[model samples]
Target: MSHSRVNNQPAGQHGMVVAPGGGGNRNAQNMPVDADGRDWSNGLCGCCSSCGTCICATVLPCVVYGKNKHRYQHLDQQGTPEPSPGCCSGSCVAHGIFAACGLGFIFQMVNRGHVRHRYNIKGSGCGDCCTSFWCSPCQLVQESREIELEEQSFGTGRY
Candidate 1:
């Protein structure tokens, strides 16, 4: 049995591998709070904190959901790709469709989980589902604010 090696190293494409403590790992950065995790930057009921977002969410929830999801996905990334396919295409459309069928909460709930995970915000999947289901408008606004705050911290200069 013979094994091929490169300079006595394993032979394979390792370009995507990020060496530990070698830098370039964004997720390795410090989380905001202690090991118990941190509370959401904005309270669940703090809808009035951003009136325009609340109004937009109330009037056009699909658009708001799409926009929030888009922003959240790109929160820590660099560069301006596009807004989000869902914003102008599938995302908003599916949200509208699900809303009409009374299942819009499911879509937003998944995104809510992503936001919580990204920020290390303390909350359960059940809680996120309930929040998305019960107070959708407020959830949308809250997520919008959270993503906005993160973007501000990153200094991307686009809101």
Candidate 2:
């Protein structure tokens, strides 16, 4: 069976007819029609905005680390390092250092979680199953550590 480009379509509905340069198909079900009545299949719509993409990228990390105490502490203490000339040097200076070093470490740890891929069972037997990889910041890191241990035991350098 051929996969359809349309995200969602009712049963027995004709799929969007895709052509070069995003031509073809004028049906509302296949393409989202805008207020101006322009056909989105003709490339009238603008690409996703930078802010939208950033939100998409940041959301996973936020969801994963938002509840963690360490992540909260790191964010709460950001950019306070190295006291100003007139500022007091006690807690302020300490906080500044913590923000600088702590934020970097925390970001690194969170980013690592954001990039690691996960797999899911696709079919009945191992031979029939296909692996799908997804990057999810919410994934437990201990699972990754366990996978690493298994790989080491099998003498696999990386997988």
Number of the predicted model whose TM-score against the real structure is largest: 1
**Model 1 off-target regions past 4 Å?**
1-32, 76-87
Q: How does residue 125 of candidate 1 score in lDDT?
A: 90
- Candidate 2 TM-score to native: 0.17
| Global fold similarity of model 1 (TM-score) | 0.72
- Model 2 is weakest, by summed lDDT over 10 consecutive residues, at 115-124
The digit string of per-residue lDDT tens for model 2 on 12-90 reads 3233333222211224223442332222221212212333423333343332233222322322233111121222323
For candidate 2, give the lDDT of residue 17: 30
Candidate 1 residue pairs that clash: 86-91
- Which model scores highest in lDDT? 1
